[model samples]
Target: MLNRANKLKLRDLRLIKAIAETGQLALAAERLAMTQPAASRMVSGIEQSIGAPVFERHPKGMTPTAVGKILARNAAGLLKGMDQTLADVQSAITGQSGAVRVGAVTGAAVGFVVPAIQKLKKTASGADIHVDVAPSDVLVEGLLGGEYDFVLSRIPAGTDPRQFQVRRGRVEVIRFLVRRDHPLAGPGPLKTADLAGWEWVAQGLRTPLRQAIEEAFVSRGIPLPDEIVNTSSLLVMFAYLGSTDAIAPTSREVAELVAPTSGASQLAALDLEDPIIINPYYHLISMKNQSLSPIAMQLHDLVYAALSGES
Candidate 1:
């Protein structure tokens, strides 16, 4: 019997990579210069070899199911290394060496990493960098897997600072929000009872941000309203905050940027009138036997610099 890892062929891996990048099968096939049928067969063979279909075709042409997305993402990393040795690809051509791979916390993407990418573009132009926005837990695991050179996260309080080479940084603050047209969007400072009546668009419970949110309600002796809408999609939450009376609380910076663009943000951040605060968002890294590519180092400095002015 072939070992599972040995079963995947180069073609299968390439197909998965293409599909992942294009977000559909036909587009991947076109990019690969293969017939759609051939592409489909290749994917099928891969699935059969692995004992599971890598993609599910839908109205969208193809969408990676949860497992498929992860496998595809992993496959790209594997392929990135292989292309250099065999074909001398540009990614490998430019580097001829290692590059920076970072896993950033969700909040850090726009507020920290994005600006860092800008800085890196100017200073370490030759250094290749890859960043993905993921929750803190996923990032920690990726760091252990050698998938991430470094990470930024909002870890639990008193969590071992040495565990992931924690970098001390301040937290990003967040608050409750509602559409500009919501009844409570008016100027009065938010009373705890005012929140009890509405549904909440909450953050990932796995995050400290959510914990702070829950604590805020609890501190007021208010029961979390039954209409809790939990999600990690900031865009979705922003859209809801703009279009409906839905209450979506978000990071102060993200809220400020979108609030003007969003009908709700123009309203107000409810003053729960409490001293509660979210956990600090810290940068986690692997310091043991660790080094960053020039680009990665630039990104690291830029991350701190960008957020230096921010909370």
Candidate 2:
């Protein structure tokens, strides 16, 4: 019986994978930055231990035997699992596991995510969280790939949830924003034409809400300003709004970051009569590893409770 210690390990699996990938011993060695002799030795060592000639020599290049093909297939799965293990370890040591790695679209971070973390801290004192703020599509990808334990994003209008294991949480409003002193802050009816001259800070043009809004302006033959901003940075946008006459539109939950100081409301949120509903926020989670640590579970509950309080 072959002792487990002498059996194929990560190194052997890597050698086989490299050989399969490059299709030649000399080239595989070059790809791995090792000498041809070293590569040959590795292949021989594996063959001796496994008691099978794993590869066939041909004029064109090397090819795996039938048994070698089976080994390679199994090796791929093993290597993938090993890679996941290493990544999980790194993420946890760097503060990402045994806890929730939550992702949110840009709008939710400053106001909703930060405050929600604070609230979760009060109860789940020992839990850890790693938060990522990104565009909706990116965060959803992370959530689906198991890189994120949970995620927060609005369901874009006309979005099909079929590809995701979605959990609808709650609906929320988004509105246009301007510095309180801006000319339209106390306004009655300001149309797209009012925003023609000044550079406007907006979500990416590809985003559903932003795209739809821009389409409306274009359809009306209103010439958009020369300036276009594409950052999901709320604080930066808020600062710009505070400094100049720029206006930003975002979610109500996200807009909570703008609590005015000194009895001066530095910002005022506006509802668009022809406004677009940014999206409906949901508690998005990965389909993989349905098993979550106690802490991860607790964090999810806290966020759910906080949103529930609003209803």
Candidate 3:
């Protein structure tokens, strides 16, 4: 029985999959470009190899038996894996047709990762690129968890930086944002003290951005804003800003990305007397010893080159 099963061919599995999909031998045969009589003979041979009936023939069509369903399911997986193998081989040969997953903080997602993706797609159209934009901690976690081929983000505080192969990117200058029509949106440059009285849209208390803002206020001998909405979602922050007189602190890149020049933006960055820059900038990070697949490496190099200004 083992020897007979070992003799089953790819053609047999494909026929089984087609038969399961179409439900009729004649339809399956047409789909596979085989004659109906040839399909029947092949099905007979398959059943013989399994030593069990794989399908039950009815008046209208055929239905897969329990064994047939299992075989068809496995065949589908095998066929998909075979297709991906071919694609990977083509990618290795031509530098196209592979997938890469990247994680980045929102600022880097807009400033760097986006441009690199655009450039890569223009040349390697068959390459599949995925991007996740979140906070630095989230991006770092994704990078370490094997969810990303590489990430553009900071190593979270207290995390051992030596665990990753890091390439320092750019420092992110913080900016305060408000709706274009807010009271603070007028022409005069304001101090950090001026912002302390307003309702603020901020991330969680423990997030680096939030902590930085708090530290800035503390350093300048100003009380923290008494009313704060804590959230990490940009959409929520935008919605709050649109409806109320609230200030949002964000990276300068994000402020620029959402400014009126980029699109139909209702947000404007506040002109500050002193800039509040986060000390830890984002970096291009990948696992220390793990090598990326060829396609992922291609994108990794493209992003790294953009960071280094070589591209």
Q: Give Cα-based local distance difference scores for all models.
A: 0.70, 0.70, 0.86
Worst 10 residues of 3 by lDDT: 256-265
Write out the backbone clash pairs for model 1.
none
Q: If scored against the real structure, what TM-score would every candidate get? A: 0.60, 0.57, 0.69
For residues 261-296, what per-residue lDDT tens digits would candidate 3 score against the true structure? 446668888857887777666789999999888778
Off by over 4 Å in 2: 1-98, 154-163, 169-172, 187-193, 216-223, 259-265, 281-283, 308-311
Candidate 1 lDDT over 2-100, as tens digits, reads 476478778777888899889888899999999999998888877777776678888877877776787788888888888755644453444433378
Winner by TM-score: 3
Model 2 worst lDDT window (10 residues)? 277-286
Number of clashing residue pairs, candidate 2 = 0
Which ten contiguous residues of candidate 1 have the minimum total lDDT?
89-98
Runs in model 1 lying further than 4 Å from the true structure: 1-98, 125-127, 155-163, 187-189, 260-272, 308-311
lDDT of 1 at 230: 80
Q: Please, what are the lDDT tens digits per residue for candidate 2 over residues 1-311? A: 25632688887887788788778988888877889999899888888888888899899888999878877888889999999999777654543445678887765565456777787676555456799988777777676677977777754446566655565655555567888888777646466576677778877777755765677678889786688777777768888888878778677665665633235567876655555553454454445436656667666656666656641
RMSD of each: 17.3, 15.4, 7.9
TM-score ranking, best first: 3, 1, 2
Model 3: lDDT of residue 258: 85
Candidate 1 vs candidate 2, TM-score winner: 1
